[model samples]
Target: MPNSDNPSFQTEKASERLQRHADEISVRLTERGAVPNFPEPDDRTLRSFSLGEVAEILGVSGSYLRQLSIDGLGTTPETGTAGRRSYTLRQINELRAYLARTRRKEALKFCPRRREGEKLQIISVGGSASTTTSLYLAQGLALQGYRVLAIDLDPDGSLSKMFGYDYPGICFPDRYVSMYGALRYDDDRSSMSSVIRRTHFHGLDLVPGNCELEIFERESTKRFHSEDLRIADASIKMVSALKEVEANYDVVVIRCGGGIFLTAGAYGAATGVLRTVRPEWPEIMSMRISLSFLSHFVSLMEEAGMSVNHHFTKYLVTRHNPRDFSQQEAVAFLRKSLGHGLLTATVWESDAIRDAEVKKRSLYELVAGAVGRSAYEQAMETLNSTNAEVMDIIYEVWGRPPMYVMRASRIAGKASS
Candidate 1:
């Protein structure tokens, strides 16, 4: 061991040294061009959807959409090679709005935005794959014409990266504010609307997360130990914050982090809770512990006179490998154990999803065949099917028929006529 009197042995505190290392790493990454400099938020644009994709998403026939374009009804789509047409997300929304206005009978189908008496839906997604699940679910809802707000509660800022906020790389504390600014218990707390940032996804906004969120956890814990009952009330700070921008969105999807304080706030604000789990045995066991903790948290909230009720609570199995016997066995076991609480559709593990993430994009943001055709198709099928099932649940909670069922009824009526 070095002598204490030796000047060379003098060192900064561990925390200070670690922070310096992080700053050095970030600087090195920028210098090496390993990460792109932060682009303008408007510079990140979603790819246009082909005519078939728009038709499917809008639950309308291709012929009807083509005729509408010919008649100058909605925004004209961009004509591509060989006269193929594609619609930007903004154009798609314009078409949805036009159809909802002109065709009142199918307005709900055309524009699924919430109506009077419908409370804003807030879904909290937690567990190992929370970031991935939240990313797809929020973008999927936006694609289907629902106004969505995605709040990133993770200190790691993984979900923020997916939305083009690259945390330390692009989103620095001095510039962009995280959800912590809105949820902080001090007089400096800002309105939630002020912290909200627009994303490339037309109908989806983001409250990006950064290192500052970790401060909320530390402060809240200190308050709790000091016998501050206000901390209990602050557990619903997210709910209070969301109310300020409630009218702007139909749903809010929150990616829960590991911090108990923030996770509790997310749980308190949620109208629904989706717990994601991998199909491996170890992960399943870990999920059981998480569920037990959730139960205890709910009890505590209830004891404090806070209503802990949710519209729905569901488990989603992610990163599923159908070819693996062990994973198949795990899925079967989960289905048996969780019963109706488990979603029927599982998100398959696909190379396409991994590839997209490497580029800091979601599968939804990629054009068809951007990845290998077969891989992309399989990945999209898994995502669409999984999100569809969740949407059906949301519809059921609202006492409305499933979208597929409504579409089928309309088609049946046309055939009978």
Candidate 2:
């Protein structure tokens, strides 16, 4: 009998089609080394290069280099032989073209949905409880009129629900499209925009999370080769993808899931570095564990062949309660490395925050209401104070930014107001 089963037949057909495409891509890689062009990239065309090689070529820090090497920078590295990391030349070349495009600042006017020209910032959030921080920060990004894609890399999908996510809409997008699924199953989706999902906001798009992320962990653990494919790898993939979409958004905000302390095993980590060591006291373990996690995360990324670049990350501490030990410990650890954009307090923790959240808004959004207005006025004052201190740090570190300007901005603003 000829093929009669629709589901089975479709799956087989899809598999076959993907295999053929893979062969074609493989051949192309052989010819081009994944770069779009040999040495000359033109206005009408895009050139590609390998991710790691590009990092070497540019001499950027390691953390920034990892951004280039994404098929989807798995939160961990995809390990095969001991100490070996792998990447496809096609994906690598795609990333190379992306960086090249951005570096050249070439004028691209492709996507009709996109406005004429805007600078897109790729902001990825990583750490436990990054959702709240990302959302709060996203309000600021949205206010700036930059198109934003808030990606929920966690399996829990908290960010998706924060603004209300749709399962059927994404799962069965128009024609049951899983941009990632199609790539894995049929090799149709090459870039991140191919899977871009719209959110409630006009300027925001989402590539929401799914329970299948659990399977990615499970399969990786079993196969053991993809150990370094941490979720951040996905950040690299999406960044490269967005770059291909012609820099559609001004900022791409990624919400990293919980601490590596939770997913260390999945990443095939030493387990000791990823886990908290037990001291004489339970509190001691917790204390040391938090510190260890901070250092360990950077170390793990380095181990996976990604360099640590300070410009690539900013640490934010939330809740802001003076009494909480964990929060206190975290803040102390964070304060040592100041000037990297730390929001030491959550606005909701204060009355100003509750009122602001209830309004489905930001503290800045409430500048008109009496309480909202008062809070923001105070916030600006505080911001000015903080900026002065940061400026001092900069002056101390660099001996440049005249200290007078820092003190003067606050004093001048106060007198004018």
Candidate 3:
């Protein structure tokens, strides 16, 4: 069963009605004194569905069930001969719920008016400082033509500098228009429009960061101590800011800091979290620690009576060196361990990326002139391929086309209007 706090669990009609549907069928069969030809598995036996049985239950063919598993939509059944494969009742229920929602979506598509305020996905990218992986992914998405707003919440200002902001710290006065401004609680929420600044890269905007942003921790702590703020208030502030400008961008990527206070806030507001981990021993160890922290944070949020809408956490392998035996071994381990949770994208090691960082330019803007032609091309290919995979994951989760495609749809909608 899905967690009660999960938004999808709360609103998915098919999921909510599963038990009732079963009960109604059971009652009708009992009245008729019918001996059911097929076995009706108990709901408690969620992990006991054979492939053929579940297929019959969901009204989908066995081949379709296999395809869904292959496409990473549902759990992979234990493999056996063509007639012997088996699935879990939980997997079948989930698939049925998914199909129901998809059918509902298709029906809604032909309706007269689209729903107002379609969700603007806010993806929180969290990782250690060792790999500036979040920044690369953000730039890649922007270059791929998505309307992307990248908020730099790290007090180190690395993301700020990468976009050509030379300042080490945001000045005091500018705090009102920075991330601090957006998360600052007041009677009238500050407009994120004024705080967002255009970056040099096309389709990418920045919510500039600086060391001064660290003051958010102090302010949040003060509010919490005074009993005027809840544990979830920081996240509320973040979500509210994004909602205010929801129509302006297709996606919002927040770069979280090292501190739990900031990262927890970002997690609370995120639809999903992208975790970048390098395939090295030390980095893998850190990744474990980070995962544990995230788990604890979610538990605390639930305990504090906050409704968590977060659906998934994905892992991206960064700084991978194919030739290194240890890295190859670790990558293999991760693939087996994480299974579908691991992204198809892998950021291969490249010196050109380091060069771009030193020059304070986005990797998307790097050219053959700055680095050797061959090296630049190779780097671009690796980065673009990795980002493209990430984009596929985004599309799957958001169930929407890219911003450019959405623009045409919007225009056609208006012309009809």
Candidate 4:
């Protein structure tokens, strides 16, 4: 037998120490009629902590807590107000574990706990180049504290580049790194997750698209003989790919590219389709044709009782000049023709937006004294307002009150400063 002070004796005494603790707990409870200091794993596991309480416990600032949520580290809080958001004891423990792992420089994983009725918005635009509009919308959504995944369905990869993934250059040699792999006829269904990439912005992820998708698009055309089946199949694959990671995002915005076939695919996958129409007659005429086509297809599908995901088509009046009578008239004409289908906010054409695009940066990132700073500031104001308005409309469509309006205001103030 080793001495009581020896390591071997201490190891043997550990169980005795626990037994003594239990005896003490019983003595204290009987004498004082109060609970002892023993750990209550059950109570701790069932406990819920408020956001502020969690922040206090963790010794972090409110802003830091918000960023943790933005970075997909914290659980989403109940809707109403940020102050009302609560974290479960389990979530708090998970966050602590995450912090410990981070301190050790280990790779971290984020798995979002999604609530019911969370929407998946797949945005599309009218005309030749809608990537810029899509990027701005995504930026706005992320700023509003929503997890956004922007999918660049275009072969040009313009949206990918806007988010800092260079065209053709960012493609990995070892794996099929784009949406191309997911759409292929192969049985590998997990390829969509591989295409998920984090962006420079918080709360935003990207599914990088490139010219490589053209090969898949062409192959799809050759394989599917019926136009309906072809469009249906493409939509199914695209939507399925999105659903693969649907739990991780609040919205999925697809900046579509390629020909009518690809456009049809987008239409099939959309929960909501945002179409931007310039204030011009020819473009307006083209939009009318597009609307008619969409309506006809939806009507046909409904009549057939086919199981399909129908989308609400919302029109945005872009490139407007309020002072220009022609542009104003175009907007008025659209409102009268489309009634409630048209978005209330109009996106003005500004050199500031163009300058930011030239620099490959977002309006929120443009600094003062940059070329067209005044114009950019004006554009930024309008963009913030439009983003909020559009968000309200979307939330209304999804049958929920807007959760991040206040957060959006905070983000706008931060960007302005």
Which candidate number would show the highest lDDT if scored against the true structure?
1
TM-score of 4: 0.66
* Regions of model 4 farther than 4 Å from truth: 1-114, 169-174, 188-190, 226-229, 293-306, 402-417
Cα lDDT tens digits, model 3, 24-63, are 7667775697633222222211134566555643434678
List TM-score per model, in order.
0.86, 0.47, 0.65, 0.66
Write the residue-wise lDDT of candidate 2 on 104-215 in tens digits.
5421211112233323444555444356556655544443234566666566666655555534222221222222331221244434555566654446677666554454
Best candidate (score: TM-score): 1
Candidate 1 per-residue lDDT, tens place, 298-396, comes to 777778888877999999999999999999999999999999999887889999999999988998888656778778877877787788878888888
Order the candidates by TM-score, highest first: 1, 4, 3, 2
Winner on lDDT (2 vs 4): 4
Residue ranges of candidate 3 with Cα displaced over 4 Å: 1-118, 129-131, 186-189, 226-228, 400-417
The total of clashing pairs for model 1 equals: 0
Where's the lowest-lDDT run of ten residues in candidate 1?
Answer: 167-176
lDDT of 4: 0.66
Span of 10 residues, lowest total lDDT, candidate 4:
37-46
